[model samples]
Target chain A: MRFALDLIESFRMAIDAIRANKARGALTTLGIIIGIVAVVLTLTAANGLRDTFRQSFSAVGSDVIYVSQMPWIMMDDFFNYRNRPPIDLKQARELESKLQGRAIVNPYLGERRDAKYRSEIMEGVQIIGTTEKQLHMSSAVPATGRFLQPFDVTYKKQVCVIGSEIREALFGSANPLNQMVKLGRTEFRVIGVMEEQGGSFFGDGPNFDRQITIPISSFVKAYGGRHGRLNVDLAVKAPSSESMEMVEYMVIGEMRNIRKLRPTEDDDFAINKLDTLIDTFNNMMGVVLLVGLLVTSISLFVGGVGVMNIMFVSVTERTREIGLRKAVGARRSSILFQFLFESAFICLLGGLIGILLSAALTAVINATLMPASVSVLILVIAVVVSLTVGVVAGFVPAYRGARLDPIEALRYE
Target chain B: MAVIPEIKETTLSLNAIDKTYDMGVEQVHALRGVSLDICRNEYIAIMGASGSGKSTLMNIIGCLDSPSAGAYYLEGENVAAMSENQLSEIRNRQIGFVFQTFNLIARASIFHNVELPMIYGGIPRGERRRYAEEAITRVGLNDRIKHKPNELSGGQRQRVAIARALVFNPSIILADEPTGNLDSRTGGEIMGILDELHAAGQTIILVTHEEEIAQHASRVIRLKDGEVESDLRVDDTDACIAPSESLHLVGGATS
Candidate 1:
């Protein structure tokens, strides 16, 4: 009960002290506010990116694995994999028949190109070249018309499925079904408008919403002349009954056999999964948050030093008051807590203001650009960090105040 | 000498108290082998020149500082062995101090200034408020409870300081030049309050260099060159207490 009263008294005194030196206190808190704001804004954006990433990757189907030329997170030198052979149309067809019951396989690839409808042009729209099975494998359902048919691939028909972003950019509000749009130099009839896939795994490049999908044969016919070697990515969807590990094991074995790898030779092809991308994304996010916090904390360190300097001045200015308190029976701990609480309260106030400001800014950004929201965990962490900074910064000065000799202090003019 | 009534309890005893200050190359002796005893309800004045260590003696008595070499007893407890925390508790519970400058917290209200000691003593809110108000009323500053020290006159500020000292009901009220900063008239007003407190059975040790201030106490001890030069008791209608009491003073100092 007495401890509680002491805390209450200390808090009251702290408030009074802060209020008395409003300008100095506010100036000291400014550094903390700027630091917290930077940290919060960066972390909030990172958090939003992580959330968007999970949603986008989950939409790509968690059970599906990709067979590509290079690993998503490259474990070794890239030059070593340059000699590996690419999986072509013939290999995809053979794998389809070989693994019919175990999985649904779809070979696909994409390149950035301009898509045009009349006068409207959408630049950097991903032109995906894939078979009919990608509609199920990629979990992209047609929002308007039908997806690509098997005939479209086998007969090399000029038919395409556009994403919502391409639909909006090229056709605006017009009915896009059967409307012809130019993918590179080839004009293809829009068979379907795919559902809105709003997020990109790699933040800026190749958003799913801005893609146009056509049959692999039509893609080869349209853009095959531009590149000498076109590597097709194979997407394999495993059965719900089999665990991903089991699926991965079977896929690895089949891939090695098809590539004619010796028992001693390492498998040349890389089978990448969504989890690999997710892990790499997480690692990148960690670095972003770490660098942001580290840089901002330098400002916070300056702020903490400011607090310490001001506290020393405060103690010196109130030497007589401290002496009087001591003479009247205040313990050393009481004096220590009083000053410590003052600095902590100042930092906490700055942190709260920073968070509130960042939250407002984040809301504006979410409305104007990307989707972002500050989480409760970040709020708690920000508060804890401010308090820790305050305590650490306030220690030496408060110790000096606590240890002031009453006789000498009282005698000080 | 007149007979001193030995009926009341002894509140303070300082035996062979010595204090030294190391000024780097030279050692300055503040108090050398000083001993004294004070009983309940005694209004004693300690008198000395500036370098005679009267402040140091007051500090020791109030448990603010320990004697360099001596056993100082307060209410039969050996105070020299007390820890800093214990000394703080002793200062809080047993000694009330009044400074020359009325050392009240300048930013706090008169009521809060008076309530401070009780707050340190961990007295509950209701009791502390009541005691604070009563002390303020006793010092006749009932209307200025909400006023800060700067908002009051010099005499009123001293009264607030006195009320703060009284609110804790300590064993001794140690006033070091309580009226030093005030004009004679205002100083008299403060002295009147002390007189009233002493009349109501409060033990007070007033430290001052002025003979007029020392004359107010029932007993006076004069120090010179770090040793007591004279110890005397005042009697009614006469300056000094009878010769037998004077002999006891000599006996007490020598023995």
Candidate 2:
């Protein structure tokens, strides 16, 4: 009970002292404000990026694994992966037959080309060549009309499915269905238009809504076997997400067997899961968060030093007052807590302001840039960090004040 | 040796208390084996020139500094051996101090300055306010309770300090040159408040270098060269010599 009362009294005294020197208090808190703002914005930006990545990545089916010639994240010995043989259409077909009835395999390849419908032309449009099973292995769905039929790949039909961006770019308000558009040199009719899917946070990943899909036979004829190199990536969808690992092992085994690699030799093809991309993304985000916090912490350290310096000055300036308080029966802990509370209160004020500023910035970001919002967890972290900084910064100066001799302090000029 | 008077309950007892200061190259003895006893409700003055150690003794009595050697007791507790926190508690609950400069926090209002001691004493807020108001009223500054020290006159500020000293109802009010900064007329008024508080059964210890201020106490103890030079009690019968003549005679004899 006594401690509670003392705490209340100390807090009141701290507030009084701060109010007496408003300019000094505000200036001392400025460093903390800048530090906290940087820290909170860094965290909030990372959070927004993660959220955006998750939303865009959902379009890539989680239960599907991609068989390619190289790992998504390369390690040392790039030559080892570079020397691996290309995964061709023949190998994709063989793997599909081996994994028949257990998984749906869709082999796809991509090329950047210009698409033109009459005089209106869209440059650098992604054109993906895949089979009818591509729809079953992805979250993509046609907004209107039907998807590619199985006979389209067998007969090398000149029909194609276009994304919403392509429809908007080439056809604009006109009916795009059955409209023939020239992809590179070949002309193909738009049989379907896929729904709009947003881009990734980094803007580096494929813009799903700006791509068109055609039959693999036609794609091989026009784009594949250029210099006898055909690198086909097989999208293998498991029966369930839980069985993805088991199907991955079977695909690896089938690929190794089809390639006729010795038991001692490593599989030439890389089995890439959605988890690989997510993990890589998480690792990259973790580093960004770490570096951001590390740099921001330096500013916080400088802010803490500023607080300590000002507290020492405050202690010296209030030496006589301290002496008077001690004479009036203030315990050392009371004096210590008084100063500690003062600094903590200042930092907390700074932290609250920083959070408000970050919230405002997040609004601006959401309105003009990517998705960003300040979470309750970040606010809690910011508050805790501010308090911790205050305590650490105020400890030495407060301890010196608490240890001051009342006689000498009272006599201080 | 002074003749014994009627017996009374002792409020403080110092037994050969010694205080020393280490000034780097040399050590200065501030108090040398000073023994004294103060009774409840007694108004005593300790007088000495600069470096005579009266301030040191007052600090010891107020529980601000511990003796380097020997024992001291407040009421019946062994104050010399108490911890820093315990001494602070003793100062908070049992002793009130009015400094030479009136040490009221310049930024605090008169009410807050008076209420400070009780706040440290852990009094409830409502009770603290009541006691603070009562003390402020006792000092005859009820209207100036909300005024800051800088806004008040020297005499009013001193009165505020006295009110702060009285709010705790401590065992003793230790005033160290309490009116040193005031003019004679204002000083007399401040001393008059202390006199009234003493009459109301508060034990007051006044430390001063001025003979006029020392004369207000019933008993005066003078220190010279870190030792007690004389301890004189005023005789009420000899009104003319009681205030000045007898005190000088004793001082002359002792020196």
Candidate 3:
């Protein structure tokens, strides 16, 4: 109880000391405010970027691995990747046959084509061709009508599932299911409309909501392979997120066997997980956050030095006050705590303001730029940093003040 | 550690206290072999000119400074050899100091200034408030509890200082030229308050150069060149007037 009272007294004195010289206190805390703001903004921005990537990648599906012509993060050697053999439906079939009962493979191919219904035309619509199994590998779920059936793929039916955007653009308020939409001179009956998914990511590419899907056989019949081979992306789905690595290894070996690659040769195809994009983005942001924190901490250090200088001046100016307090029975430790509390209180004030300002900035950034979040952990770290800076900066000056000789201080004019 | 000397019926005793200052190549002897004993409820005054070592002696007695060579005891505690923290505790619990400049904290209210020693003594808030108000009332500044030092006149400020000194109910009330900053009329009012406190059996040790201020005490010790020139007890002196009557005279003069 006594300790609590002493701390309260110290805090009151700290507030009084700061109020005595408001301008000097404000100027000294400016550096700390700027530093904390920089730290908070950096953390929030990085969190936003990570959240955006996670959402986009989860939209692609976490349990699925993509077998593509190149890595999702892009290879360092562009020429080597460009010259590699393309992924095809043949390779997808071979992998599925070899891994039978172990996994599911959904071969996909897409083209940007204009979709139309009556006189209305929606240009740059991503039209994908895949088997009925594509539904299992992706997060897409139809909100209207029914998804494609195996019979549609077997009979090579001219039926398709329209995305939310394509449905809105071509059909307006009219029900899109059972309606006919034209794609590149071919008519397709719309079987379903997929649910709305927000925010296109992956370099701002068109999202799944802006695409339509049809069976691979029908797509082959409508648009025959112009390069004599079908260029496809085989989305290989594991039983669960935990089994993804094993599925990836199985598929890589199957693909290499299908291609008849030599033992010493690097695999000609890429097995890309949705998490690689998140990991790469995180690594890049780590560097950015480190640099930002370093630069801002220098300013915080400068702020601490300013606090020390002010404390020195305060001690000199309040010499008689110190003597009077000593004469009244204040111990050396009490005097030390008084000045230390003053500095810490100033830093804490700056940190709180900085946190509030950064929260505002994060909101603005989320509205205008990208998604951002300020976690409780970041707030805790910011507070701790400010307090540490206060103690480190205020130590020497408070010590000198504590060590002042009462007699000499009292005698000082 | 040096053992404390047993001295009965004594509130303060300084045995052969010596204080020296090293001034570059020369050593200045501020106090050389000064010894004195003060008993409880004794109102004593120390008279000295400048460089007579009275201030140094006062500092030693108040536990503000340790003498270079001495065995000083306050109520049988070996104060001369005590640590700084111990000395601080002694000052907090045993001595109430009234300075020449009326050193009340300028930014604090008269009540807060008086409450300072209690705060250092770790008194609880409720009790501290009660005791502080009582001290303020005793010093006749009950109406000025909320006023800061600068808002009051010099003599009122000194009263605040006195209230601060008495708030902890210390063993000795040490006044070092308490009336030095006031006019003769206001100074006499302060001296009259001291006279009332002394009459109530408070041990009062006052340091002053003025003859009139020294005349208020029953026992007067004169110091010359760091040594005691004379120690006289003027118990029957006519100047030691009754406090209430003197206060009445002061009121009439002021009005």
Off by over 4 Å in 3: A18-37, A82-84, A111-125, A167-189, A204-206, A220-224, A252-266, A298-310, A353-367, A371-375, A378-393, B1-8, B23-27, B222-255
Candidate 3 docking band: acceptable
Task: Report clashes for each candidate as comma-separated counts.
Answer: 5, 0, 0
Best by DockQ: 1
**lDDT of residue B43 for candidate 2:** 88
How many angstroms is residue A167 displaced in model 3 relative to the true structure, after the best TM-score fit? 4.2
Q: Model 2 Cα displacement at A194 (Å)?
A: 0.9
* Tens-digit per-residue lDDT, B54-135, candidate 1: 8888999999999889989898899988999999999999999999999988778999899988888889999999999999
Q: Worst 10-residue stretch by lDDT in candidate 2 chain A?
A: A198-207
B125 in model 2: Cα distance from truth in Å?
2.0
lDDT tens digits by residue: candidate 3, A1-413 = 44455566667778888998899989888877887888888778778877886776566888888888888777578878879988777777888888888999888888778888999999868888888998898787899988888999989999999888888889889988899999987899999988887656665564877889999889888875555767788888999889988888888888889999999999888888767866777788889889978887888888888878888888888888889888878889888888899888888888888899888998899899998878999999889988888888888988888899999989988
**Ten-residue segment with the worst summed lDDT in candidate 1 chain A?**
A198-207
DockQ, cand. 1: 0.67
Candidates in descending DockQ order: 1, 2, 3
- Model 1: reference contacts kept, as a fraction: 0.65
Consecutive 10-residue window with the lowest summed lDDT within model 3 chain B: B237-246
RMSD of each: 3.8, 3.8, 6.6
Q: Residue pairs in steric clash, candidate 2?
A: none
lDDT of 1 by residue, A1-413 (tens): 66667777888889989998899899888877876787788788888888877877656787888998887778788888877888777777777777888788899977888888899988878899998988777677899999999999999999999989889888888999999998778899999998997667675645778889999998988887687778888998888635778878888888888878899999888998887888888898899889887887887898888888888998899999999999999999889999999999888888898899889999998998778998998898889878888898889998999999999989989
